[model samples]
Target chain A: MIIKRTKSHIAEIFCNVLCVFVITVVSVNAQKLNDDFFSPKSRLSFGNYLFLEKDYLRASNEYKEFLKTDNNDTVRFKLSESFLRIGRYEEAANNFKSLFFSTSLTDEARLGLFKSLFFEKNFVRFRQYRLEENYTTEKFSHDIDRLNYISYFFDSEPLPDSSRLFSAFADLNRADIKKFYYMKKNPDTKNPVTAALLSAAIPGLGKIYTGEIGDGITSLITTGLLVFLSANNFRHDHNFRGWLFAGFAALAYGGNIYGSAASAQIYNAGVKFNFDNEVKLFFEKHNYFLPEFDFVNR
Target chain B: MKKLFYKYFLLIEIFVVSSLFPQDRLSIQFDYANKLFQTSQYFDAITEYKRLLFFDEAKKYSYKAYFQIGKCYKAGAKFDEAIKYFSTASINAANENEKLSVYFEIVRTNISRRTTSRALQILDEIEKENTNTFIRDSINYWRGWTYIFADDWKNAADAFSKIKSDHELKKLCEQVEKEKVSVTFTKAISYFLPGAGEVYSGNILSGSITFGWNLLFGYLTINSFAEERIFDGMVIGSLGWLRFYRGNIQSAEESAKQKNIAIANKILKYLQYEYKGAKP
Candidate 1:
């Protein structure tokens, strides 16, 4: 009977332990759920989730809400990133500027600011800001220099020599840069007056000079044939026919002269169009030579 | 003491089991997913809904989760993914009502993908199943939208005609059809008589200029040949007369196509922005 009573006593101890265990486990889970749902950092946590999903607008709002009570570098970087994703480069630049001083995120924010400026396509300001005394990250100077050089291609800045270009850029893209440089320096410009004079002196010669071989051949053959016909008609006593052929020949000659000048203008336009396309494609494919930042990474 | 201890342990076990069992654990996740969806985070919403389905032990929200995922994909313009998830929902549907909703979503996604035939086939399936008048009308509405997206205004009109005799879209389609010029006719006319096609298509200045040049060059070539000027005849006939004639015909064909595009664009733009109807 005593042993039975002892067993009962131990069972009571076990039951109380089990009861406490259940209550504590349930309360802990409940508390965690409540905290996750209604805590101060819930919006921040949700914002990070949204950022990972790349929902910039909503994520930015959440970050802004969290920033009302806190001032942290990571959230600031993300807020700027959210602006950058939606093409609000001015806001992105302004936001990025906040994290650009003496923080672990200084390099990232500096890069972000420059990227915003680059994408804003305001080349003048981008160049000017990069030269600003404290606005650059030392580690990313080469990247900034490459972007600065690329900007000159689209703007009025005369391209610098190959020696002055970034060494990293030289290894991969020096040839293209030099080609663009030469095109800028010694453009294949055709003078309209010279082309017209060439066509007048020798029928269709100006079209050949402008690289329109087929048109030049056709014009030369037609003008030559018409002139020959006019001369032959006059020799055969068909005077009226001879005068009409002469008039037609003169018209053809004048039209060819005008067409030659137009062709040169078109050739120059083609040159400009091709150059513009090449520059745009190169910069776009290279992402303006900026480093890929994993800001949205979880 | 043993009896009380046993009673207390039994109560604790019952309390833990009953409370946790009645928690409706997936409800919180469902609400969160819905919140994500409402905020326009479509891609994120898809993940949340998918996660809800993954964690839902009882499969209570499986159908709803899959359907919401499909809706999210459709919003993001990911039509193929949308259709896949919608099909999964249809397969897992507990009743005909669930299946009908899934089918409707499938048709909508197919229309946005510009797959008119696939959308029509689903509509046919819905018809064969003999749904209610409301569903039938909805099918016709989306089918009409599918036709419009496919650029087949005549068929779009025909589709909308099933809903009512004088449906708004049908009337618009009729107007566009009447106003649009026939591209084949323009091409054939230009082949027979250069510049006539352009004139018919309302390009008076271009047609006049084309005809004038053709006439002038034709006269020159014929007169040269009659005067036994073979070289001049050959050069002007091949270079001046043939080039202008071919160019006129080509330009006439192009103008007809352009006019057709312009007429279609007028309707498309209205459908895109101004029309207050259901759109894809």
Candidate 2:
């Protein structure tokens, strides 16, 4: 009877020990699991996965969280790159600028900052930043120079000396770059005032000169028809009809002259548009002459 | 005896702890992302969901994560992105029910985007595969909604009637059909009599002016011809009478189309803003 009582006492102690073990293990494991899920290393792992997937927005979020605890230069560069990829140029520039003085990524970051400024279309600021001796990088100076030369194509600024501009690009790209340079310098554009004078001399001549052959023919036929109708009405002694037709003919003549001038302006705009597209296509094909980053590709 | 007791105690402790906690890292992550979604922080929610996906190496939460991401895009009115993610979710669906749910989401998105033919095609495909009455009914219901979004009230009414003889949506569709002007009738009436189509389309003032001008031109053309002034008759007939005649038909067709658009827009606005039912 005493032995049975001892066994019962042991059973009670065992159950109590199991209960305490379960409570302590569960609480500790839960807390550790939660912490580990969002720990710095875990965030870096997830951020790298997202970055490789090209999901930059989420990757940037993860990288930002990771940066709060770790000061890794590659992570900072990638964070800036993520911003650049997503078109947040201001944020990207700021992030890249933060890596300027004390990181192995100084040159790449400077180039990234220049790229951000260029993409923002802040040409003046981009040029000013490029000219800053302290901000310039020997490693990517040629790349920055190529980007600076490319910027001139986007605006109405006069093209730089052809030799200097061509020298910034590789020999393979020089022909296309030279073509863009010449197109920018001397765009084959018609003068609106000249077009107006031509149309005033002979109806629709200016429209023909502006590459609107169909519109020129229609204009000529319409004005000629109205003038013929006026002369015909006057010959038939219908004075009121003749005067009405003459009024219409005069309006058509003035409208044709105005339309010719507008057509010439449109033609010039088209020429500029085509030139811009070609230049853009060339730069895009060459990746704006920017050096490829092996780390990013990997 | 002590070693066996310790082993049993450890097993009991493990079972109790696992059952009590239930949630692992992935599940906790899912909850965190869901909380972001519940708060209507869609963009952030998408990022969190993506984070879950990136770390969910077992792919246990892939279907839910993708489906939720699709929902986030839909809420943002990014329909193309929504469709793309929904397609991914459908590909990852583990069960027939999950597949059906993703299909419905895709159909609903297509309807919202006004891709009516694609929505109807998906509904048709669902109908062909499933013989279950409840699933068939759901297919018909979505088919009806697709027609309504396409502005084809007649087909909408037909589809809803297949679900129930006296369905409320069927009745609404019928009412919309009644309210809309018939473009064909408007064009036909204008062919018979100039400007009569516009009168039928409820533009009484414009119709009256059109009729008066056409009659005046007709009279002038006939009078000039009767007076043997052929040139005058030709000029007036070609430029005045013919121009007005063609214009009257075109204007009538345009008025009818405009009236139908306004009717459809009114009902659609009600459905969008006031109607308290599940919608595509």
What DockQ, on C-alphas, does every prediction get?
A: 0.17, 0.31
- For every candidate structure, what is the RMSD over all alpha carbons to the true structure, in angstroms? 10.4, 3.8
lDDT per residue for candidate 1 within A71-150, as digits (tens), equals 88889899999999889999999999989887779988888888888878888888888889688878888888888777
Clashing pairs in 2: none
Taking the tens digit of each residue's C-alpha lDDT, what string does model 2 give over B1-280?
5665776777776776674567788898899999999999999899889878878889999999999999999989999999999999999999999999999999999999999899999998998999999998899899999999898999999999988999988998999999888999999998888888899988888888889889999999999999999989999999999999999999999999988988888888988998887798
Please list the C-alpha lDDT of all candidates, in the order they appear: 0.84, 0.90
lDDT top scorer: 2
Single out the weakest 10-residue window by summed lDDT for candidate 1 chain B: B17-26
Candidate with top DockQ is 2
Return the top candidate by TM-score.
Answer: 2
Q: Give each model a TM-score.
A: 0.58, 0.90
Fnat per model, in the order shown: 0.28, 0.28
What CAPRI grade goes to candidate 2? acceptable
lDDT of 1 by residue, B1-280 (tens): 7578779878877877765665545677687889999999887677667556655668889899999999998999989989988998988899988999899889888888989899989988898887688878888888888887777889889988999989999999888888888878987888788788899888989988998999999999999999998978998999899999999889998898888889989999998899998777
